[model samples]
Target: MANDNKDFFERVYQVAELIPQGRVTSYGAIATYLGSSRSARMVGWALNKCSSWHRFIPAHRVVNRKGLLTGKHHFPGGETMKELLENEGVQVEDNQIVNFNEVFWDPSNELL
Candidate 1:
């Protein structure tokens, strides 16, 4: 009766919650933590539709595998997702993550 699978979206948010203010994670990283690499796109879909949960999820902190800000359209200003990230200390250049290896947050290891 719990509709366990229905919580995939919630699980996605839980993972997002683990991303620190000045760091970021990939959609694939979050999907893998949820036990399915194939779910990365689904994770993106959930974030795109998460209009009410934006404040809680920090959906702005998630980017593509290559660290590209591919979800910019979903942001409230429609183009400042990168600016928001920059404000959080994430260095974005040419629409790609700079020093990705350093700023990446692996929730599996970093978060309890």
Candidate 2:
């Protein structure tokens, strides 16, 4: 985690925590929600280290802009990320959400 940007990381966690069960969001959507449209990769960076946090963060709900489980490798087990999503009633195929637009939860639009 970037010590100087702990606040940013915390903000990312905050939004991640709000993602509804069975729904997903993109790192770029979260970054854009935080008024940092260019910080999608930073959002991913923050989520990659969320395991160290004391509280639970639904990092699995955040995927790449294309609805791909690009962060799956960051999860503990081989299929942990996909399993988590599937458990939430979100279908995945070939590491991509089956119904991305239907399950996508855009913070900018939903949190308003």
Q: Top TM-score: which candidate number?
A: 2
Per-candidate TM equals 0.87, 0.97
Which tens-of-lDDT digit does each residue in 1-69 have in candidate 2? 356589999999999999999999999999999999999999999999899998999999999999999
Quickly count the clashes in candidate 2.
0
Tell me the spans in candidate 2 whose CA falls farther than 4 Å from its real position: 1-3
For candidate 1, what's the RMSD?
2.5
lDDT of 1 by residue, 1-112 (tens): 1456448888888888778998989999999888888988989987886777646678889999888999988887855888889999989888888978888887767765
RMSD of each: 2.5, 1.0
Give the alpha-carbon lDDT of every model.
Answer: 0.84, 0.96
